[model samples]
Target: MALSARELWRILEPVHGMIYFVPEAQERFAALGLDRMAGYFASRAAALGPVSGEVVVATFYNFNPVIVHAAVPAAWSVTTPAALVEARYEAVGAALRRGLGELADDVSELAGLVRGAAERACEVPQGRPLFAAHAALAWPEDPLLVLWHGQTLLREFRGDGHVAALLLEGLSGIEALVVHAASGEVSAEALRRSRGWSEAEWADAVEGLRSRGVLDAEGGLSEAGLAVRARVEGLTDSAAEVAYAGLGEGERERFVELARPLSRAVVASGMLPFAKR
Candidate 1:
């Protein structure tokens, strides 16, 4: 698609949330199967680096620390029925319980690791705090399901300056930027009416988003951008396992690195998204 100048600029610019969901996120759900969880993790690791993986795992443990932590040691158990997998599960559980305990007590340290990792790997912009965007794209009505979700993501970062409106301009017809506003799904028509812009003016706005790299003709986010947005959110979701316990520096960094390649593999194969895949 022939993007306008604004569009091109938007595409080139750093989006606050594009670098999410990477390959390594799968480990966050190694036992249950990655599904959307895998792709989401990969995207984050790619953008934020491999360290965030710990954050993701911490979240995972919070949700069901007992179960997820147990998955590992179970494989090495020595008892008749429990020796193989059950023992191994217990071993893994013991280690996680301790890791989670220490992190639950330290906030500054965890924030420091997040800050350093955010700055180092994500190349965070000058100001503001950027947490992963939290949203549920699709879900199953079935109550039996208790595994990963199939929701791709877009993060919200601290841009150097105001860019949401600019992003709208850049997407234009080339890329229809979509945001679930309070009213409903915000789309081009909605922007046109609310902004009171002529077709030319709207096109101009979209052009801007494209240039910033927030909007692209192929899709809203570029490959790397999508990776970042997805990765951050994925980690956040993975962290659910651990809940308030959060993550420490070492563990968070470790996860980000390990999940990188696996996330890529799932996305590349088109099996990351639960429903479509």
Candidate 2:
């Protein structure tokens, strides 16, 4: 379902706790340039449906279900943050529209300025500067920061120092496990296999998430665990803001230039190196 004006606003917001989440996203978008990704974000925004409390909840969950669960109930304060992000965009978009009205002959430069401004505003670099304006127009201040912050948390994927997190972090050695704990598929198995552990070791890893309620008997994401997973999924846009915040005025342009090139490198370089490898 498409988000109503209010629902859209809820998904977009200003937030204090998010930067340093998933940073690769910002770099990727910048390097790809604005045109490549704007349509995607716009589509995502459109697909999100009306921003009810549940929709808002899922927004955070999609980032990294675990993050949302860990921060549970605390992360639901949507109204205030949403309002702030929306308002800022509205004011800016209105100004830009007026300037566009007067400068028909200056369309190219005007568009460039608008694009640059939106890029900076969304903290997302170039790929879809207009998406930010659309976000601003669609939902006001909420668009700039909330989605950005929520997505970052998910991709950064932190585990609790508690049982499940600690075990999964290692995923290499353990004994006790339920029979159904063997469905990680390649990615999950890769997590265990790459660790170079035996079957018994992988079983133990499954049990850990199970015991902590992070995984079900079959090792799929449980409801609570899913929430955390959601929190991190939409990490790209959120991290862009942090990248922007860190850039400062002096480094901003340089940062954008680097993002454009480095993002291409991430793909060209192939799969990222495994920290364990």
Candidate 3:
């Protein structure tokens, strides 16, 4: 059977996501005077070229704007966007090299496949602000970095579509996190803390979801909420499918086959702390 876009994401996400959790990346960011949250906001948003916190709030679409405001603009003062970008690439490369070891030497083929899809995503950059910004950056020379950059672009492309999907359901950023927590995949406390949403803000979003019949009395997803979640994920996956249009089914399967073990190696190396979450 052909792999779906969501399945592909599941397989490839670890490769790119490791950068956020690895100590190497954090150390690099710290050297630049960016704390953990500030590093995250600044490094990820660096491709947008020192954009304001408001732009990060809009494009990121999950974090509390207050946290974003605390990071960006201020972060730009500590380190230029270009410097952050270079630091992130260096960090990701170091992390991948340490995590992948021997597998790093054999990533050219996988990188080529993922880069093809990422380039395809770049061609239709309308409405995908984050993806477009990353796409505007020059491609990395190393195959491992290429693979990482490709997955980053694809992740942002899917993320932009997901924001649109959430909006279609009239879900605010906090509300979307609430509904996701209600699905039991992640705890509400974790989401709230990670996104820097206060308890009051979370309660308001929960109350709003309950009033809309998306959550039941116990704060779990109601049938309607499940349907809404399904629709949002479906829309996201459908939108992401466009990136794979250039790949034949055989090639897509090949990419997954090759990428799975590498991603698993990254996961097994314990570089991706969120994988435990």
Best by TM-score: 3
By lDDT rank, best first, the candidates go 3, 2, 1
- Residue-by-residue lDDT tens digits, candidate 1, 80-188: 2112122223322332223233322323332342333333323323321122322111222221110011111112232211233223233222233231111133455
- RMSD of each predicted structure: 18.8, 17.8, 1.2
Which predicted model would earn the best lDDT? Answer: 3
- Least accurate 10 contiguous residues by lDDT in model 1: 143-152
Better of 2 and 3 by lDDT: 3
Instruction: Please write out the lDDT profile of model 3 over residues 85-137, one tens digit for every residue.
Output: 99999999898899889999998998999999999999899998998999999
Question: Candidate 1 or 3, higher lDDT?
Answer: 3
What is the model-wide C-alpha lDDT for candidate 3? 0.92
* Residue-level error in angstroms, candidate 3, position 43: 0.4
Show model 2 residue runs off by greater than 4 Å.
Answer: 1-186, 228-257, 269-277
TM-score of 1: 0.21
By TM-score, the candidates rank as 3, 2, 1
lDDT at 218, model 3: 93
**lDDT score of model 2?**
0.32
Stretches of candidate 3 exceeding 4 Å from the true structure: none
Higher-scoring candidate on lDDT, 1 or 2: 2
